[model samples]
Target: MIHEISAVAFRQNLGEMLNQVQYRHDSILIKKDGKPVAALIDARLFERIRRMPARFDALCHRIETAYAAVPEAEGLAEIDAAVAETRAGR
Candidate 1:
């Protein structure tokens, strides 16, 4: 379960709080004046989210189609030119 702690308490007991987070892998919801202000989560959890695949390929395809409507180059020549320029540092 997630742990809730007041901002003041968190500031006063940071070391102990970090120890709890390290051992328990529990997220901390920091509150200010009885309202949630922020959260402290483990780094591994953030990495897991970063590695996960996108869930909306259909949405991405629709957006790509809409973007393509703007009408740019018709072939790979433009892309190849850009890549060559980048490789030459220019």
Candidate 2:
């Protein structure tokens, strides 16, 4: 669940805020003059997000198709010649 706290209050109770985040998986929105300025989120939450699998295979297929539409270079001979030149340092 999300909670809101003033920036001053958050500063005063920073330890408690961090403890709450680690134990409860709660998110805190820090407000300045009643407007939200920042968010405090637990590291574990980001870990979980990173571990979750992507849900849309169609999205991946679309991206691959778009990438494959790009034209290939005209000749590998030019690339090989450049590589040989680089290896010779000439």
Candidate lDDT (C-alpha), each: 0.82, 0.84
Per-residue lDDT of model 2, residues 38-77, tens digit only: 9899898777766665535567778668767554563456
lDDT of 1 by residue, 13-59 (tens): 88888877788888889999999998888889867766665546667
What range of 10 consecutive residues in model 2 has the weakest lDDT sum?
Answer: 69-78
TM-score of each: 0.55, 0.55
Q: After best superposition, candidate 2 residue 31: deviation in angstroms? A: 0.3
Pairs of residues clashing in candidate 1: none
Error of 1 at 1 (Å): 2.2
